[model samples]
Target chain A: MNKVVLYMSMSFDGMISGHDDGPGRGLGVNGEALHAWLSDGGISPGSHRPGVGVNAEVFDEMMQTGAVITGRRTFELAGGWGGDHHDGVPVFVLTRQLPDQPAPGHARYVTELESAVAQAKEAAGDRNVLLHGGSAARALLDAGLVDELVIHLVPIILGRGRRLFDDQGHRARNLELVSATEGADVLHLRYRVVSR
Target chain B: MNKVVLYMSMSFDGMISGHDDGPGRGLGVNGEALHAWLSDGGISPGSHRPGVGVNAEVFDEMMQTGAVITGRRTFELAGGWGGDHHDGVPVFVLTRQLPDQPAPGHARYVTELESAVAQAKEAAGDRNVLLHGGSAARALLDAGLVDELVIHLVPIILGRGRRLFDDQGHRARNLELVSATEGADVLHLRYRVVSR
Candidate 1:
């Protein structure tokens, strides 16, 4: 009975990154326009790396979560930290390649999406699990692993970029509107996933 | 001098319409998602006719302008009432084929962008001018005709649709963020055009 939440920022366009497979081209830098609120609140911290001017509230929310899940491509792009572990949080990364060693403490890799979800649920204890990354997040949502969707809609349009939900064809997930608010350059909307 | 503003609600993927050119389908059933705010206010009469069910506030602000401009495609789609004139407001539409007859009153046909701007400025006689379509709006913005961009960032994120700004490369138009507020399922943001 654990909740899996998807929390991320997106542009008016469905793109999560400026360009696909283009380094530093993440969401066309136009995506950064959507993160102005997070940046202003110091919630996004320069890069995904923890520490440095990090927003305590946002960090605490992520840290207190039971486990973290991400896509292989997202992890790989993070270089060494792309594995299933960060800040003492047990990380479950979806991948096909077998790893030689554990990424960090409490980190592991899995080939099957369902296996990863079950593992993350076990590791979560009583805390809710957090699903990260674009593709995996969409997959998790499709598989009924997501309980809430927290989307922070940023105010700037990136004409083109990496699609966040490119393959969400014919999928319908009814959601209970939780809350909606305005952040600097973003609109924070929270929806509780009811049924898929 | 005329202060030209660009206004439109875009999709999450930055599309203005769907793959088809037919009405409703492009923006989605009478622009349901993008114009939810308008309907929520009991303003959307569910018809395309002008001066009907339009919110008094939206109509007042829009008409406060000196004149209005649109592309031939939009003007034609709007049917006869939306020619180059409306209630003493000079309307200029960008088109290769000129209208066969004079459009009622307070209207004239012109094909030049600059000429349209000049005519709009003259009509306002000290009021603002509004750009009201995709290509024509984009052209004005690209040509440094727009002075401000006031947008209602609707909440619905259509995964696919026509893009307001197509793939064509564009020059950055500096904007000074004025305000961002939450309204119904939309976020309204105002920006002053700083530099072209």
Candidate 2:
């Protein structure tokens, strides 16, 4: 079975992105600070910036993910993942209205979140289904679909912004720590979602 | 110099306490779940509850702390820390109005935060001074006085509650991760406040 994993970089204050985050700047203005650890390790294939550390190992693992599920806002803001996404894997975008023409290669738009996740899981086979975007992850978590969560606990505190677990009327869920690793500028924490 | 350390148990959502947090039920209804790690380790000398783990070591270190500084709200809500406090240390309550009568051996009310911290530092001598409560920690952070932060990261997420780093017009401060240790059910993270 394909596991659904919510993986993201979050500030010490729990914000996934800064207050001014939007289209041109997906992480917001200074939001890049949250990913400075990745920048130092040059882990993000999209940016091609220089960085070195434990994130390299984590990045390599993430590259093995077979499918990506995200919300419309993240897909639109990220400009459809550009040319940095993994090869041959489908990217499912959950949105109310489908795009007139889908991007080339493997991007698909769906109206309902459940079907999008289901389709993504089927496409992923034995590999993991990566959940990107705070809203998308929250939706899956609310539905108790996220099997794992990988949080890159950044060392800075934004003090305000888009909290990864913003109040969405979701009931409390227990998490079991699977592993913890020290990175150059962040703590890589892996947790398994305990099913109720 | 007496280092001021901000110590608190926070949920995965960054909340220090839950929505219903107040006197009699200081951490809120479900907020106690956050400290279940401490409860298991029996690190709190005041409670004497049975608990075992790395928290015991952390608790021993905390017991060496010479003083504590907290906001009026936390002090009042906790009913003045009762009898569960470090031995022979003064707990300064930062408030505008001094209680008609201070609690013997444990509590003292002060009108100014800075002065209260100074007094706590002086009273602490060579030992570390602990800053407790969300508002009090925020005040110290805003004033650029906190030397370090020890966050007991609990696995549960309380969607609604008082966040430790709630927006208060404070500038972003960088923290250097010093250590990360696994405990019974919490992650003990220590970070040094990098002052610019």
Candidate 3:
């Protein structure tokens, strides 16, 4: 069975991005004061540049099981890719405006959050589902679709920014910590979502 | 010269509390799963008990500040008081819908973020101002009024909760790391806000 997971970063105050849709204000954007710990990790957390991080094992594990899902804003802010194959993994973008099949070899866009999740499960096959950011993740969570979540807490506080989850309703999903690794500013934590 | 500072723990995915409107969700309702590491702190981060970690030197320093600010939610969640008084220190409550003032010392509500900043600065006299959360901290940051930020990154990822900053707007503030202390699952980091 595929488990849906939400993994992301937030500020000490609990904000996902800076205010006013400010560019570069994601999570600890203007306030990297706390999150500068991630600078040691090289590239920024949201940037999808490959071949980074000395500890890619966990990220690799998180990615190996399923297709990636994200919102359009997240897709564009990370400087949307010319090609969608993330280290050879297919990605499904949740957007109401994009085409059903944005790319044949690597990417596809879907409007319905349910179908996107279902397709992601299908794509995962025997592996678990890794639910990426944007509205889709919130939608899945609100619908009680996600099973597990792994959060890479980068020490930073934007004091404002696009929230990882705000107003989006999600039923309580009890969780058990599977592992914890201390990286510079990013604390990698994996959890098994146990139903209470 | 009031140096406004914000300090708090947040989820990896950017939530401040789980089920913010639900019972016991004000502290870590959905965040319990994400912040399980705080358990090692001998006191859960969301205990909401006044003086839970009040004995720390950091807490002493924080309490001695000239001014303190927080959102109404936090004030209410904290059950009004947390032991000692501010010794006539000026405490500002950031809110549009003001609630009845808590007993003992004095608290004034401000609807405008800039006014609150000005008031905090005036109240500080010569001391630094401490900007705490619910949403008032976010409002101040959104206005680019905060002078410094100190975040205690607890090593836990609450899978669900209210976020620190979501898609608001604020300018980038460069920061210089002044200290890093590993206390239980929380990493206490202090930074001087830098400018572009």
Maximum-DockQ candidate: 2
Clashes of 1: 16
Cα lDDT tens digits, model 1, A1-196, are: 8877776776644556664345434434565564555546443544442232333345356667888888767666655364334556688888777788766556677888889888888989898788777888777877777887777665444656665666345244445557665544456566777665
Better of 2 and 3 by DockQ: 2
lDDT for each residue of candidate 1 in B1-196, tens digit (9 for 90 to 100): 6688876665443445544455433444424555555556553375322343333355457667878877877666555344434456877878877878765455566789898988888878888887787888778877878887767655443445555766565544445566664555555566776666
Model 2 CA deviation exceeding 4 Å by range: A41-52, B41-51, B99-104
Give lDDT per model, in order.
0.64, 0.82, 0.59
Q: Compare candidates 2 and 3 on TM-score and give the better one.
A: 2
Which window of 10 residues has the lowest lDDT sum in candidate 1 chain B?
B47-56
Q: Candidate 3 at residue B192, lDDT?
A: 62
Q: Which parts of model 3 are misplaced by more than 4 Å?
A: A1-4, A7-66, A70-84, A93-103, A108-128, A152-161, A172-196, B1-4, B9-103, B106-130, B135-168, B174-192
Each candidate's chain A: what TM-score? 0.80, 0.90, 0.74
Residues B1-196, model 2: lDDT tens digits: 8899988998887888888876776677678888787667464475744356588777777878999998888877876667346786999888767778865457877888789888999999999998888888888888888999999898886778888988664667788999999988889999998963
Stretches of model 1 off by over 4 angstroms after superposition: A11-15, A19-56, A80-85, A95-107, A111-115, A137-147, A151-160, A165-196, B18-31, B41-56, B80-88, B96-110, B172-176
Which structure among the candidates has the greatest lDDT? 2
User: How do all the candidates rank in terms of lDDT, highest first?
Assistant: 2, 1, 3
In model 2, what lDDT does residue B75 have? 77
